[model samples]
Target: MIDHSIDRDPARPDVGHGHFRVDEKRWDSTFFGRQIGSLSWTELPADRKAGRTELGRIAELSDAAGYSLVECHVGMTDFTLISLLEDIGFRVVDSRVRFLTRWTLADVPVTTPLDGAIRWAVPSDRDRIVELTHEGFTDNDKFCSRFKNPDYFSAGDTRRYFEAWIDSTAFEADAASAVLEIDNEVRGYFIYQVRGEYEELPVVKGILTAVAPNSRGANGHLAMQAFLYHRLGLSDWFLDNTTQLTNTPVIRNHIRSSKRLDEIVLTLYRRPAA
Candidate 1:
């Protein structure tokens, strides 16, 4: 297991208030020494001073490692501290509508019938998921380019992308992912992690979801959502989806299908050489 003890700040009053943990790991050469992962402070109480101190440490390390990018998803309820992050220069790379739909054994909806089949992913599905992910990006040239960019997902970097997802799923299956198949073909998938205590309110943190071009319709979207709700049975869940404000169709869909929970304005700041 990765050693988180080094980053742990014991005296912080909000340390575990909201299931928050200050964890950091070495970044790969691909990220140029920049530690490229999240710091989970969602469970911490909203203390501006504490939040700033924690973020300052992160910013210092990121700068030393030459990492210019940092991304995080905070609970909608943690407004004060999230705003503090913006003041420190970490730009909101993207904003996703947080949506929740309660469920019970009785409230389970019928699976949306589609051309494809849905099932839990296995080791055998890895290659197919990788292939579909790379190919699906082609439908949107701009989207593909972001990944293809030298700073991001370059051509043939599919291995890293796929491996990241695989590793995440292996580490936490409950909140990891589920795949969508069609006639035995892997067409799309969703990656999430179960959070919160069962005794309290349970929530699913949806990290990523994608559908192949051929599967980009209401059927495909509904199928994926249905599968997650039915299989996971998470009563309260949140989906942090990334989309441009200009994308009217998607924005409209999120507003309609998922209740708007919070809005965050992200801005990136580049630090001058120390």
Candidate 2:
């Protein structure tokens, strides 16, 4: 049997660092109103048996520690770890794909109402952005939103969580953040953080993009994107963005803009067997 060890973080007792560990997700727990945990360390453990042993131990320990669920996000290419997680009863919740868009700005003019073009997000746009985030994310009708799983999260919890998330980061961008205004109303917004630079050009990572439901079907999405591109200065930054695997509009736009596929992430969750 592989020896199980725990790491003392003073603030957290469930954290460990050997083959695997279950790190308490205090933020998520507070957000969802429960004790939640996550599998720490993304890399696959060297010994498969040891990893399996620890996975089981962590599940039991997490349950005893009051965590109602444990979540893990791993690269889709890591089949070995996926198998181990599946073997230990973790279930897939969401798959997200990151695309590398050398051109983070859209090429097509894709015109709409002149008022609907994207502009830099301001402090006043916080509430609208939060509302849009809530509306855009609450729907699990077509695609499975990661946090909307009935087994783990409540009906309105996911939307509120995202609303709070975007609210927190609404105007707090590392490099640049922009919004789409239509008829003097904020229709959508995006946040770009500079990860660093690539040979003088900034490496910008698009962290969040959301469009209001009422703004759909009018080429507004592309229009806002193109405006963002122009606003940031065309073809001058290394950019990458991620979207849910089932997000067809973004996937199509990424392909049309010549953005190559970068990576795929699979999110899984585990809980005590009832």
Candidate 3:
């Protein structure tokens, strides 16, 4: 089943006006009365007290629903709420560095050759995408369980999301999406968006990128770099990809590749039922 917990609530005006939306379906889960699992709030106002109250309510709901973990992204410079979350038992789960490599008109690098072929994905690629996603995430037990289990998102629901992404005109126009295929089999994919208008400080926001476990080493990285070369050229631009602190390989790869600039830490909170 697709979780609609984080979607906007039409009945509540406050929910739609802000950049944040709470997941009501998740709220109804057993985590509501004692704990919360993976909650995200974005574009929250700067009012500290109000923010705490709202978060507290969400926590209460999550506790009742039997959730034991929650996660969110906050502005790196926003210390107010970050501190509050820490005080409430949320521990810093990971720190991620945001890096940028720019590309200019004259500096575009030729696409690197891949053992696999890269191509624009169509609706037909949906099943393959879902399969790759499952295989790619299985290394992380928590993520794999959350995504693979029928309680979270069924195979059909997963297909719907992939289909939507494959068919999105916006994704096509941005040129930030593609699938990697090897020997007529889909191996991986990536999705990103260009952020900012100023050429001097443009950012390429990565949405998702994953490669199947069975794919050769660096296939994922090569595909990602090729996409960057194609879209942003060879000039420097800011890009950030976040993963759990436990994911040491991902962090090391970003650092080793000089693809990260600075790391920002965020907490994941949980309150198990009594």
**Candidate with best TM-score:** 2
lDDT of each: 0.53, 0.71, 0.55
Displacement of residue 83 (Cα, Å) in model 2 is 2.6
Model 3 lDDT tens row, 144-228? 2233345334566444454444444324555466777778987787766665644466666665667776775845556655765
lDDT of 1 by residue, 12-99 (tens): 3222223344333333324334444344554554566776776666566555544444445554566566566776664444444433
Ranked candidates (lDDT, high to low): 2, 3, 1
Residue-pair clashes, model 3: 39
lDDT by residue (1-274, candidate 2, tens digit) is 1111223357766455466678666567666677777786756668899888877777677777776888888886676788888887899999888876554344445455444666778878888877776666666367567677787777777677667666555555454677788888888877766667765777777767777767776666656556566666546677777788888887898889678888899889888767
215, model 1: CA deviation in Å? 3.2
Residue 248, candidate 3: Cα error in Å is: 2.0
**TM-score winner between candidates 1 and 2:** 2
TM-score of model number 3: 0.57
Q: Identify the superior model by TM-score, candidate 1 or candidate 3.
A: 1
